[model samples]
Target: MAVGGGLSCIKYLMFAFNFLFWLAGTGVLAVALWLRFDKRTEGLFQASDAPSTFLTGVYILIVAGALMMVVGFLGCCGAIKESPCLLGLFFIFLLIIFAAEVAAGIWGLSNKDKIVQDVKQFYTQTYNNYLQTKQPALKETLRLIQFGLQCCGTTGTIFDGAADTCPKKEGLDAFITTSCPAAIDEMFDSKMHIIGGVGIGIGVIMIFGMIFSMMLCCAVKKGRNII
Candidate 1:
């Protein structure tokens, strides 16, 4: 009976962790879908603009959300089972994700200026290449690329609540369908399947870890009661 009680406590912890992971995962999926649909249908890419900072933010969120879900699920299982193995596995995965997030955030913040400059340089070089080739079709494609980039930055600012200096031209929506909609559509689309794939893999490991951890903990509790 004492052993069972300890195991029950472990189960409660697992359930809590699982709930949090699911909530965070759902949030990520919703935002990714919104970005893909909201902007793509509005001709946000026909004007030869750059990709927006919001898109970058979206990508960052996706990656972080995925890691969080993985770790959270593992933690839930570890706590419920009272198993040392599950607990250790959860801890290890969490540590890895925490370190990665820190590194990526730091690097991105530190190299913001450099990244901006590099993107500008690459944009120029690509345009010049199209010019030399003298391909009308390629030139048109380049125009779309430029528009995507511009919009990426401008949209980011607009969303940030800065003064809206960006031009909102009429027929822009029609132009997207007429000019090229697919290109823009792909930009915001999140690879949920990919995220799911990752989730599945991590989930398997988490399950085993949790089981081991919970069992170990319960056993310890029982032993203490006996003593």
Candidate 2:
């Protein structure tokens, strides 16, 4: 009876953990979509002349979210069914996710400065292209970013023959107080900490999931042996 109760407790705990994991995955998916579609960040995606580090990061988030949802579902099913095979599969998935998360976290941390610099350069080129081509979509995106961040050109100062968004002097309707590079750095820095914390938190949760899944698998095997 005691063993049965312990197993039941573990099963419920696993379910609870997996449910939260699933929710976290959903949140990640939402954030990734937002980043991909947000007007202010659209310039990062439209830059054809530069490497798309920001877009690549968004893609990674999307992939991670999808994997998390799958793993979470598998874990829930495995725990509910008390199936050794499913639990083993869940363990394998968790291992893969764990390794990937670790690698992503390390890469993000190491390339923090580079990512900011790349973004700054990308924004500058995009803005310049917008000036020459006057593409409505690019113009609108640049305007949104400049006004939203209260930032001007890449250096935060109006360039010679700058666009309407980066006027030489402050106007009644338009004025940029910050630079794009500073704004981008500030925005990404805050987001990076939040993302890093969430990643670490998820990684820790995955470890627990793995441990519990293995334990449950062993229990299921032991029961079969006794039978």
Candidate 3:
């Protein structure tokens, strides 16, 4: 009786966890879509010379969200049915995702400096092109960024050859002289902690899901053995 009760509790817990996991997956999908289509980020994608790195990251988020939804459904059904096969499959899926997340976290942390340098290079090159060609899209992007960040060029100085976005007229209260590179860095850096916190939170939730799935799988196996 005690064993049955314990197993019942676990099953319900697993169901609850899977439901939350599914919601998290949906949230990820929503955020990814927003990033892809948001007006603020449109310029990043519209620029003729935009880097594939950013685009690839967005795509990965979309794929991960989709996979999460699939796995979450599988887990919920497996727990409810107490099916060993489904539970085992769920375990495998989660293990793969956990491993991949760990690997990505390690790689990103180790290459932080390189990533920053690459982004800076991309921005500088793109800005130079905007200056020379004055493409409408790039121009609008620059204006948006400058106005949003209250920044000017890469160095935020007229010496870098100010665009119309840069404040040329003196005594303008809305003017900003800080360079875009520094502004960009500050903008992104401020969010790093929030990003890190969310990543860790998701990782912890995944770990719990793995543990629940494995436990339920064992419970199911034991029940079969007794029969």
Find the candidate with the highest lDDT and give its number.
Answer: 2
Model 3 bad stretches (over 4 Å): 1-3, 38-40, 147-150, 157-162, 166-173
* Model 1 TM-score relative to the real fold: 0.47
Model 2 residue 32 distance off true place after TM-score fit, in angstroms: 1.9
Poorest stretch of ten by lDDT in candidate 3:
167-176
lDDT of 2 at 65: 95
Across 151-188, the per-residue lDDT of candidate 1 in tens digits comes to 42212222322112222434643223222223333432
* Full candidate order by lDDT, most accurate first: 2, 3, 1
Error of 3 at 89 (Å): 0.7
- How are the candidates ranked when ordered by TM-score, highest leading? 2, 3, 1
Q: TM-score for each prediction?
A: 0.47, 0.87, 0.84
Spell out the clash pairs found in candidate 3.
Answer: 156-179
- When 1 and 2 are scored with TM-score, the better candidate is 2
For each candidate in the order shown, give its overall lDDT on alpha carbons. Answer: 0.49, 0.77, 0.73
Question: Which candidate gets the maximum TM-score versus the true structure?
Answer: 2
Q: Which pairs clash in the backbone of model 2?
A: 156-179
Q: What local lDDT score does residue 225 receive in model 3, on the 0 to 100 scale?
A: 82
Q: Measured by TM-score, how close is model 3 to the native structure?
A: 0.84
